[model samples]
Target: MQAKEAAEKLGITQRMLRHYENEGLIEIDRSENGYRRYSESDLRRAGRIRDFIATGFSTREIKSMSACLSDEGAGPCEGGVIKMQEKLEHIERLQADLDARKQAVLDRIEELKQGLAAEPLEL
Candidate 1:
């Protein structure tokens, strides 16, 4: 497949594909005429790399994952699983903190309502 075809299939820009190639995440064979040729496996790998990037994996982590992807029969790496778990846990903690802040704001609003009703302001 050509770069344009693969980019269309993956819904990513051609520049992004080239960037991935430059980073050694994906490789393309070159024709004798110098046109880049991508294989089916290369296309698949590009899709996975894009998916990982969309999910917030850092470029370093994506590079680490590319190694695991190179293995023919290997499943997802333990390190990748651990990193995703860590990210999820961090998100959960953030949600909890946000919830606490929201509740505090609601409580403050209710307290203001009560205090305002008791003191009947003169405008």
Candidate 2:
């Protein structure tokens, strides 16, 4: 499959696919004419990378865990495990911060509601 078709199948832009290739996330083949020829495995790998990106993982983070992604249950890779743990910890900290912000917003909304209820003044 070509870059266009593979990107379409992966539900991502062609530029994004190229960027992934450039980031060394997925390896792509070149045709005789020098066009990219993406294979099933490549697309599969792209999908995985896309999913990780959607989950807020950066290319560096994904690259660091590339070893585990390709391992076919051949035991565990310590580097991959450490990278994955770091990613999870980063996500957890972000989530905690976001939750705090959301709670602050909710409290402000409640305060606004109380003030409005006290006096329904003209706009």
Candidate 3:
């Protein structure tokens, strides 16, 4: 397949495909006319790359997961689970920080509401 068809099938833009290539995520062959040629393996790898990005994995992280990204059978790859756990832990920490901030904002709003109730409106 060509770049357009591959991009369409992957539900990503051609620019994203190029970006993935530039990121060294996948390698695409060039045709006689210098057009990009995507093989099934390439498309599968690109799809995995897209999935990893959607899950908030950076290209660097994905690069580190080369073992999991291979066309080999879908068995557990060493370090893949560790990487996912690390990402989950990172997200959990972020969620905790956001929760604390949200609680602070809510507490401030409640304090302001109480103050407004205690004060008489002066027009």
Candidate 4:
């Protein structure tokens, strides 16, 4: 299929396909006229890349899972599981930090409210 058709099917833009190719996530073939031609395997790989990106996985992390990204219908990749666990841990830490920041902001707001309540209103 052509780049446009592939991008449409994948629900991504052609530029994103090019970005994936540039990121070395998937390889696209060139037709006789030098236009990009996407094979079934390429589209499948691109879909995986898109899904991983949506799930917050970086291109570098995806690159490390090249073995699992292969077309071969192998069983579950243990390395992929490990990577997911690591990502989960990272996300949890970020969530904790965000929670703390949110609490701090809420506390400041409460303090400001109390201070305002203590001040007398001037006509």
Q: Rate the local accuracy (lDDT) of all candidates.
A: 0.81, 0.83, 0.90, 0.89
Could you estimate the TM-score for every candidate? Answer: 0.70, 0.74, 0.93, 0.94
Q: Candidate 4: minimum summed lDDT over ten consecutive residues — where?
A: 69-78
> Quick one: best lDDT, which candidate?
3
Q: Over the stretch 67-101, how does candidate 4's per-residue lDDT look in tens digits?
A: 76767723477598888889899999999999999
Please give the TM-score that candidate 1 achieves against the real structure: 0.70
| C-alpha positional error of residue 34 in candidate 1 after TM-score superposition, expressed in Å | 2.0
Give the range where candidate 1 is weakest over 10 consecutive residues by summed lDDT: 65-74
RMSD of each: 3.2, 3.1, 1.3, 1.2
Rank ordering of all candidates by lDDT, starting from the highest: 3, 4, 2, 1
Off by more than 4 A, model 2:
71-77, 115-123
Candidate with more favorable, higher lDDT: 1 or 3: 3
lDDT of 3 by residue, 1-123 (tens): 999999999999999999989988888899999999999998888988898899889999999898777677246888989988999998899999999999999999999999999999999
lDDT of 2 by residue, 1-123 (tens): 999999899899999999999999878889999999998878877887897789778998888778655535124755756666777899899999999999999999999999989996888
Count backbone clashes in candidate 1.
0
How many clashes show up per model?
A: 0, 0, 0, 0
Better of 3 and 4 by TM-score: 4
Candidate 3, residue 33: lDDT: 100
Clashes of 3: 0
